[model samples]
Target: MELTVLGDNAAQNSAGGGCSAGSCGSTDHQVSHLPDHIREKVENHPCYSEKAHHYFARMHVAVAPACNIQCHYCNRKYDCANESRPGVVSEVLTPAQAVKKTMVVAANIPQMTVLGIAGPGDPLANPEKTFETFRELSEKAPDIKLCVSTNGLALPDAVEELAKHNIDHVTITINCVDPEVGAKIYPWIFWNNRRIKGVKAAKILIEQQQKGLEMLVARGILVKVNSVLIPGVNDEHLKEVSRIVKAKGAFLHNVMPLIAEAEHGTFYGVMGQRGPSPEELSELQDACAGDMNMMRHCRQCRADAVGMLGEDRGDEFTMDKIETMEIDYEEAMVKRARVHAAIAETLAADHAKVSAPVMTVAAGTRPVQMAVATSGSGVINQHFGHAKEFLVYEASPNGVRFIGHRKTDQYCIGDDTCGEKESSLTTTIRALEGCEAVLCSKIGFEPWDLLEAAGIQPNGEHAMESIEEAVAAVYLEMAKAGKLEQAVITAAA
Candidate 1:
């Protein structure tokens, strides 16, 4: 894998590209501990000044309905005035048309400096439109900064093209660092050699993305990570995500709220629930304040937004709007998918799909799970310990129940940021040893495999946030089924 990391050197916590990694010596937040290359990028960000950041400098043009990942929290079939949705097409502009529209809009509102393609479809999933827009803008309007948000499937190749056009900012939507959560979000991915489904597909994507981010950062591209704070899925994982991205070179962190619009039929709200409120977002920002720059001015615009923050350039975004555009949503979705597949084939050094272990739950417990890491990122101490004992596994009475993890040492021991965490695959298998089931917020490639090896079956996605609630829920469910003994036995075992 050609590892090129993308991150904002100017905004990083470390300093100097060649500095030896160590405890960040400075307590200063204004001056970055990140290497000089990355530090400069953050320092130089045009948005650094309060006067430069007005809500309207960027726009999301949702041109297609195709996306590679189905985030448990997303339904691309809808539209949000603030968040990214699947079906809402303000308009589906061809690359040429998009460029033309952007130029035209720029004339009316010159404050717009960033032209971003966030999308009803993943930008990478629509490479032709994504890149072509960049190509056109480069030739027509060189002053505007080019930005794109993607699943990172096509990023490895797209980065080179973007850099060629002097593009500076990029956003990648990363949720959980685990794979089981990924399976819940993504059904299939054209990864490795063949198309993989469920957990395998998720693993491939996470790895590819981690690799791609590194490549992007190494080349001086600025990366802002958009992490949806999915409560039960990866809420606790935020601090870790911030740490890793900061280390790898991400500049700004955009922790967006999971907008669960009922009409969308996407996630969380299926239970007729609401997402985290503004207060919750504040707490999360406080929690993630460990040397990471968090994005506070997110309007969560649709993929195809046009105009300045205060200005209503809504007309510039008139591509997929049924009232104005002629393109069908389904057709645009198909085109987007084709572009995504093509981009994946263009990037990613092909690898094989690694098989994982398949352990079952004991009689009344959740399955034992494992955490997979990207290269270089080894096991973080964040693994839930007796924390595993708290997750309740819901299965048929006749279905197997996961007992518990016998070990926690190497179970969480592995690189999450670097791809070498594969070695921990062996460690994970051994950690689960006699365990029959697994419990986790998410899973990734190799760790997914290890849990399978130890006979641990994935319990799938869970909504447990606090460590205690997860454990208590397990026993509560077992007791309700008159199977609490299994929990006791597992505790003893």
Candidate 2:
């Protein structure tokens, strides 16, 4: 694969005086000059921001189910429906199935902002499946963020592939920078079609991981290093790994504890290896916290995990349930647009005497279009991410009328593939161009930001069953708040 090492001169003049730690420096003046694709890395990614975590949610699709390395701590199974760990998924989904499930999840869980390809196995080991899912998502759900976690054996060869897909976040499991320490953690690695074990495998894995880190950081991709804390095995060495990755421009370091449940069937558990105590884990995190940002809130989610951290909604949108629903590919571009355009014309003739709403729903008083996230009921009952289509209506003194509906691809499919001219969210925003307000039972930070950026009001509140009733209630609330008049004055000014 051909690799492009960004020129150092560009970095010297780039944001934050050279993109320290693969993050935009204090000044985004330089970043503003970057292409739109590059500027989008940090917007609503929950793992990258503490604030985003509270408001934004993320999910992982278990499309890749193969591995090139064997760690004593790993024992992946695909048959279990309730196991909640990295290698356990209820079912293995094809790229297409994964995309479908992601769409449904995103529509139902609007707060979901990032889509990752974590695994029942190494994502890079099953590169075809991983990239195929990514390619499909790029074309379908361009607004969502893409991320991957790897064991680092194939990272050097896969870094360019990640960039090609516009994937900006990468997590590499690096328990130690020392090969001797690594020997205790990873038992064997498949290299060049041969099984390499002991210190040789450790050394090779370490070299590739470091090289991949340097290359990723140079390309301005955010990197997070994950270190598993196994009591008496590389636990004391993670601090040094933290120092190494941080020096190589890692954005964050996550020190996770080994899950060594004997009944779970992992090699480590079979060997009776013990996981670190809470105190041990906390001490190590603190020791390395000064060197690099330490991620304290990791739940070690399953491959098919969904919803916010600590809460798993994977069972709700399983393949069996997803197959029961129907989706229209051209729902927004054709049906919704046609209906919306006609209704808009009628509303215009009826409300000509009324001054047009001064601004989108935020300013209030004027008759502006409103979009609601619903599950086909005229009621706002679905979360922002779960709505397959948005029902658009005109709200004014004349009352609310069915305008049209805009269709959105499953957002959790993955981020758009690289070099796409427009994102799915951008397209959705354009479809709702004349709309002033968006209503949903729940809203995520990313969608909220996108709507707000387009100058539309995002109303994250529940509404009455009937569309007219909901609009009337919302309008009355806006009037009582004394916001509509202010919006009119602002618009006139």
Query: In TM-score terms, which candidate is top?
Result: 2
Q: Which residue runs does candidate 2 get wrong by more than 4 Å? A: 1-40, 77-79, 328-493
lDDT of 2 by residue, 1-493 (tens): 1112111124433433211221211111222333455434643455654323434568999898899988888876424453456788878899999998877777666666789998879999999999999998888877668899998889989989999998989999888889898898888999999999999999999998999888898888888788899989887788788877877777678888887766567788778999876547656775665565566556677888887654578888889999986665344224433543454354334234332222233433565567777643235766776665576665654344443345453223343331234566776776566666778888889988998998888887655354445655676666666655543434544
Assess candidate 2 and give its lDDT: 0.68
Q: Compute the lDDT for candidate 1.
A: 0.52
Report every candidate's CA lDDT.
0.52, 0.68
lDDT of 1 by residue, 1-493 (tens): 2212322334442543311112111112222345565444433232321112321254555544467656666665554343333335555777777766676555444445567777777888777777778887777676566777788876786777878877777888777567777776566776545667888878877877787788888887878787887666677787787777777877667777766645556666565556665446646764665446565445455566555332235754454442353434344434434543543342221112211112223444432222211110011113332222121222322222211112223212233531234443454455444334454555556555656665565443333332222333443454466543433244343
